[model samples]
Target: MSETLEQRAAPAPDGPEQVRAAPIGAPVEGSADEQLPTPTRRANPFRRALAGATEVLGPWARVVWAAAQPVVAVVSGLGWVVLGIGFLATLAGFILGWSELVFLGFVPLAAILVSIAFLFGRSTFRISIHLNPSRVTVGERAIGQVLITNPGSRATTPTRLEVPVGFGLAEFALPAIPKDGEHEELFAVPTNRRAVIPAGPAVSVRGDQLGLLRREVRWTEPVELFVHPETTRLHPTAAGLIRDLEGLVTKTITNNDISFHALRGYVAGDDRRYIHWKSSAKTGQLMVRQFEETRRSQLTMVMTSDSRYYGDADEFELAVSLTASIATQVIIDQVPISVVTDRLALRTHTVTSFLDDTCRLQLAEGTFDTPRTFARETTKRLPAPSVVIIVAGSQLEAQEYRGIQRLFGPDVNVFGIRVERGARASIKDVAGMNVMTVGALSDLSKVMSRAL
Candidate 1:
């Protein structure tokens, strides 16, 4: 009985220790929770008020910013001056504590305001630009006309029009135009270089008398001027070792052929339709038509864009001119010619289009295989042997050309024209290939005259 009473009165083993330890709900000093750094962001009434105001005014601020972007883009050099002067005047007024200078600051401010008002006004004239003969040769002239028409019922204001040509700008002062009147300005485009010149959307800039705060408005669309490579006159028949109209003809007989080559003594199985009665009566023997076996009358012109083959940029230009001259002459003669350049090929259709395509041709960026290989690969796909003409730089080796000859395989009359710096234009026969080296563009016609 005493043992049962002592057991009930005494505390359990863990009861005292559990009571001594604080409950989870009670806070403890120097715990992990207390040791951590406080968060940088804390609730602030002032910041909350500012954010609430910003949310309220966000749409109006966005509207103002949207209106300012175009004005910033159109601002000219004088516009920047007005802005800087106004800013410095305001700053000086605050620093010096002078009321007069503060008012003086309004001078530039008022000038800018007036300039903005003038520039942002509605355009008074409609502008249109036309490029006459949009495609021209390198040395030919391209005419540009900017026509400004006053379409409004009232007289249009005098303004300045600027058009971008190549890398420069052409400016003109437009006189005050009557209602429903038009003014045209004529300008000559520089065609010294072979390139595509971009003539722009006419920009009309209106500014203050003090040259402050100008507004530029685009009034027309852009036009491209394609400057073609210069080419000399080459006679159609003066192509290469072979004649233009006929290829290599063989001594063969055919009953039906387009070309009347010759009449031959009639043999067994001769077609009666081909029997020449006049020749038979004169020779006292049956005569029949014999057609000369002819190769295909197709000319293949291969051009290389390999920089290694050229000694300088001038050499490349001469090569292009030579290619163009030959290609033009062949096309003019109505002989089907295939032109293969480094980055382009021409489908000999129109002289104008061909020249335009040649103008667009540019040299390849990296190294490439021998142009002869390219020529052979291109020729293999053709149905018949062609008179192959290759135009390249002078850096090519004899073995490389021999490789080109091997690539053409057989039956192709291959001709090469190499342009080099500090060299005279002359022709040479290299390993059964006729090659001409030309240093100048004028000598092209001379060389062809000698070769053909």
Candidate 2:
């Protein structure tokens, strides 16, 4: 063989010149056991000391901080501002020997003492609250009644009552109640939208006319007023795709089932009991029976309440109304239905309860996986239904529909409704899943009629 220039220039493998020809950075082969160990950097002593100190004093320091939190809160408000100014003025007046400044400072000091005394007095009146029809629909009225009773033998002095409703407070002044007497106050419940309004832990606030020394006494328990989403009439015939209990028999064949489907030529290994004797005699061959496949028509509604799934709060409200309309119509149809909304599986015992749950449902933070994935997993654990309807926000794109399609096999029918505000309503098939968009609540029935 002819020696190439490159080969001639290469170092000899088994020669004494090889060691001397090795490059400065060239690696020397060694057995795994003989290899040098990697070096580790030393940790700083200061960091170690800091970690040790944290471990020792962390719990006690937390306890002391927690103990001082209430004190800090009490002095953190405007009360502290007034108290600080008064203290500084009093000190300066004493130092300067100014009688007018001293008198001025003493006035504030006296006011502080009186305010403290006012805040410290024990509240004598007992309060109880009652909500008429605690759950109501939007545009409906709910009355909240507050009863103040004097439980003690002695007469109860009149005081101001403060009840928080939504973002505002309703105030009332009570008259002096004789021994064992009671007084009642009624307030209107605001129903601007679907919400859970905290009626009260009736707070009685006592503050000086100067807006100093404000104190609150909680006399009643807090109650929730659920305002359900308003729903329009959505015909069940248009909304439901399959009939409940006994739906149309599928063309697919099953070996042994309840419904009598069809008859075919018997194979050698076919079950002998299923053979139709009359048809065999007429055809002069063994005929086997085939039963039509039928499934109990059940509806599953998966609603997404994650804020990230919606373009805005209005979109979410539209989604909720759409869900409520369909679900309400399904319940009216007397079909088995399951409603799942972001992490909450609503109880479907009654239409009213389900509506209540929808009313109380709030937008939740998004999870690591999308809402569709969560719905798919939840559906898998449930008994497979004949129809699956997903009510998602308009934020879902065609790609998400592809992901959602993998959850159900071809045997079941799946429908998707994307709700948007002020958008045109339309329906089309996306990745084998029937999808529709609803712009308004009333448009749902029309859209479903076209889609179904």
Candidate 3:
């Protein structure tokens, strides 16, 4: 909800309303609903109104009276002499002892009726607008539609109505209704970008026989459209295992690999399948079948997004992109990565449902915001055993250095990536850990290829 109507009824000390808002078309308490902006067709806005009176009056219906204003003044001026004649007739009626009042009243009554007859169309109508795909995937198309209906018993006057389009939505106008009737139209929506698309409003004017009295009716039906950013592909290849970092892709199966660890001596209650024949023959002791550890590998990913050039959009957007890519990779690789952030889960482990769309995310200004996000998130968890990578700004950072050592442990490698604003970023190792960092988005393909 925006500010209350009372607060916005007038300008404040700051001046006019900075953000523009469309007006409500009907009463708020009415059954009418809000119009969502959608994509649709284009119709010429200035078409003329089409009423029975318009056909009779032709193109000059609205202006006929105005165009003939001078002639009307002349005629009406001469008609004043009829008032004198009426007075004399009334005087004569009085002198003849007949009623004078009736004679005087009929002249004025006839003149009033003639004046009313000059006015044209007399129908009432309502306009309805609709927007489709109220919500959309990034880059998906949205649509809009407009409907006009005459809600009267009598036919209409010659009228032209213009509907506004495109603040974020498009607008169209319809011609006047001859009798009671309907009209429809369309337009387009820009995809995946966040914006407040608004359609201007409509303009309708009614004509009279004299054309002197024109009624310009303004309509305000507002619609808003929102565009989310598109989904992009991530690094295709797995990263090479860095001796220093936590998350590296390596082929060698060991205590660290997600595969089988080894076989051991069988104990009481051990299943018969646990006995190893070859090892039993050599050592004269039974060895149980070895299996890989089912436990999830511990992972910690730190991102410092303060690039010298990363522009001002949504800090959270980039954070989300990076987090989604990394988190998904961890799950796919069979590693359980935990994300650190404030105000979310105190701790995330074992790649639970929490990691799905809600990857620990934080968007802020400056380099420390990244580390701050991490420090704030990992409150309850034990230290991790898998690789640790810190993706930060292109510039050297203090927290990156401190965070690496603070989170460091056995077999843990920490790596850093520096991103320059508006330029290609690459993954590079800042600490002894294989911490991979990139400055440019263009180099993403090359960096990703190495992992494959």
Q: In TM-score terms, which candidate is top?
A: 2
Give the poorly placed runs of model 2, Cα more than 4 Å off.
1-76, 95-101, 119-124, 248-252, 264-275, 280-288, 368-372
Ranking by lDDT: 2, 1, 3
CA lDDT of every candidate: 0.67, 0.69, 0.45
lDDT of residue 117 for candidate 2: 58
- Quick one: best lDDT, which candidate? 2
Off by over 4 Å in 1: 1-68, 77-111, 132-135, 209-212, 235-237, 240-295, 367-385
lDDT string for model 3 (115-198, tens) is 444434444767665667644434465555556677787565545554433322222334556456876554444433333344
Q: Write the per-residue lDDT of candidate 1 for residues 200-282, one digit (tens) a residue.
A: 66888888767665667888777877787888876544654445455665455456766678878888988899999998899
Give a tens-digit lDDT track for model 2, residues 1-452: 11111000111233211111122123322111110112111123433443466567888755765675444333324556567678888889999999788888777777777776555555578788788889888757667778888888788666677665543345676677788888877766556477766656787767665655565677876787778887888666575575555664666798687789889999888999999999999999999999988877788888877777788877887788888877887787788888887677887868888887887677777752786577776676676777878887878776676677667767778788888888898988887678898889878888888887
Ranking by TM-score: 2, 1, 3
Model 1 residue 391 lDDT score: 80
CA displacement after TM-score superposition, residue 413 of candidate 2 (Å): 0.9
